[model samples]
Target: MEVVAVGGCWCDFVSISPKLPKKGQTILGSKFLTQHGGKAANVAVTVSHLKGKSAIIGRVGNDFWGENRIKSLNELGVNTNCLQKTSGHHTGIAMVNLSEAGENQIVGIPGANYQVSAQDIDKYKSIIEKAEVVVVTLEIPVPSAIRSLELSQRISILNAAPAPENCDPALFTLPTVFVVNETEASIFTGLPVVSFEDCKKAVKCFLEKGCKSVIITMGEKGAVFGSDATSDPIHVKCPQVACIDSTAAGDAFVGVLAYLMTYRKDIEMEQMVEAACYCASYSVTIQGSQASLPTLTTLQQYFLEKF
Candidate 1:
């Protein structure tokens, strides 16, 4: 069974500076670039970089932007058999601003993304059924995400970045892995991320809510993984590096985790966490979302040089 990724796609406009401005403060960017970035598409590209078979299922507008995104996804070796093209609505787009301190702010317009329907999931039911792992993200409409999530009984990894509150509470009931950043973890668990111990408590809250496993990513501080089903907290530290734009660290992490799980069923939770951290670190050294992800060979060389 291969890995099938389902969700939204967006063309991102990005700018970078040393610090994000406060209300009423205007700052200039040190650099700027536009790239294709939607959590699902980004992860699919990451999976391909790991030499894994990946198929993307979602919607895009009938416009030039949407056409280009499909072309790009195809170029990355991701099968686009399920990417839908619509008329009228423009492709989804995002404005991402990255600060020199590795912080980022984004505003997204969910254009054609809002149109994904349950029928689409039914169209890909066979692929979902055969996938070793099925991945989904919240960038698409919640109903669409919920529909896609419901179609798969395989290992499901949900990268709920810029997390949403309206996702079906039933999503927590699936035999799924809930991956969220610290801020997102706080939102889902309603707790502040103040210390390492607090991080464990936050994950516990999610497990109590019924998720099979929870991963709370604390940027630079590392990530914490495990749940009530596991015996101990698998704490993995990220490699220290000179920071640049951190735009796609979380996406890279999710993609790598899914890819590694395809080959290593009994992979130590710590091993998976560390590989993800390494992938995230590699992302910060470059710019753009999918563009910055390292190939398996590149990542291997990176660790040999750093360690």
Candidate 2:
């Protein structure tokens, strides 16, 4: 495997509302759709979309949705042999509410997702060891992620999301790169990330935790990447686009990042991050998770037309 994504897999039940509902309010939605989701699953699908060899290790319910999740990943060309089905649990699920602005509010019920354990990591160690890069997310338990980090042979990307209230400081130092979107950056470091200067301050805070490198995705403003080895931090600005659904932008970024780390190992980090930003920016121009991701052929066409 070129990349193995370890985390959660869920069925997303999405609805488009005029606005996100507030406390004690009832609202009507314009549209509804059921789609494939889960942070790690989204990452794997993104890698496969880019034609990279990808696998996913996680658990789902032994139910209809679980079967559908596995089948979809297979159709997308992601290896699903390592994904497991839990007997007594329901497949993980997320109720997604999207506003016309393309912003989303999600409430996830982590059924079999929380079932992924350290023992599961042991069972999949060989698969995990074969990758040049292993992408992980916090949608699953912290201990399982820790176990994967301990077993990973080469590069590991810990996308610390849904930010933990109490995190093991060592998690920041374990991976080849620690990635977070602006909201997560603010949560983990207790610093507001509203400006480029704020992102730099957050970068300093993360690097001081002993990471070799860190990348913060700042949405429409683009992203910032830095390394402990170099004092300079690189900021790559994204091209403007008419945004639709912003839900999977980070997954697109992480997916492209993992893909380049696997197949374009000799490329400089700055170039890789820039490509990821472009891919993520493109994802927002469409709607739906996984479905919005661009294939290698499509992305090439997009570059020709847009660039």
Candidate 3:
């Protein structure tokens, strides 16, 4: 298949309002919704929309959220042969609050996500070995992530979000494509990423730590990619759009990037990068995470018209 995404799944309950509340304070929310979201699942859905054969490998609690997650992934056209149902435990749950300014605060219970172990990863070895690209995130335990990284035969793209202060050193040895946001970059490099120069240093540190390429996404300020271009970081401007929920913008970008690299044979790197940048931009124009991801037709009609 073209791309395979492996990680945990979460059922997110979100409340949107003017702002979050202070400690011990309860604030009224203007709107509320529940949706299926998980880093890997969101990426898989985005990949399917991009016309890639995306597969998912992970476990879900045999609860309602778990049932919904499987149905949602299937509806999105992601291959679910590798999705397993656990007998005990609950599907991961996230409580998210959004402000009118498009800012978010989230708390994840991480139920079944935490239960994904090395053995579960081993069960999907053949699936990982057959894809052109494998995209993973930190939603699951590090051992599972490591196992996937070890078994994957294709390009491995890791989005180390909810950045852990430390990880097994073996992860540094994988042929990984590192994707992190500004805060994650700072955490990884121990330096503030206030400028493009700071981002370059962070990317350098990541590469030296064993990544094949480093892409640092900087919200509305755009993103910086470092690899072969020594003259300057390949900077991409974020498209101007009205702000909305930005919860899964980064996932959308990474998913689109992997899909394009694997399936868009005629496109150049710069073109693919631009497409990903635009995808992230479009995601911010809407609300929710997976709901915000743009379809290929939507991308062509709205975001890529000027290109």
Q: lDDT score of model 1?
A: 0.83
**Candidate 2 ranges with C-alpha deviation above 4 Å:** 298-307
For model 1, how does the per-residue alpha-carbon lDDT over 219-265 read when each residue is reduced to its tens digit? 88889998766976677888887777688888889888888888667
By lDDT, the best candidate is: 2
Tens-place lDDT per residue, model 3, 54-169, is 99888889898898899889998999888888878899898999898788888988888888888988887888898899988888898888888898887888878768798676
lDDT of 3 at 29: 90
TM-score (C-alpha, index-matched) for candidate 3: 0.94
Q: Where does candidate 2 have its weakest 10-residue lDDT segment? A: 298-307
Clashing pairs in 3: none
Clash pairs, model 2 backbone? none
C-alpha lDDT values of all predictions: 0.83, 0.90, 0.82
lDDT, residue 47, candidate 1: 90
Per-residue CA lDDT of model 2 for 63-171, tens digit only, reads 9999999999999998999999999999999999998888889999999999999999999999888788999898888999988987899999999987898999778
Cα RMSD to the true fold for all candidates: 2.0, 1.5, 1.8
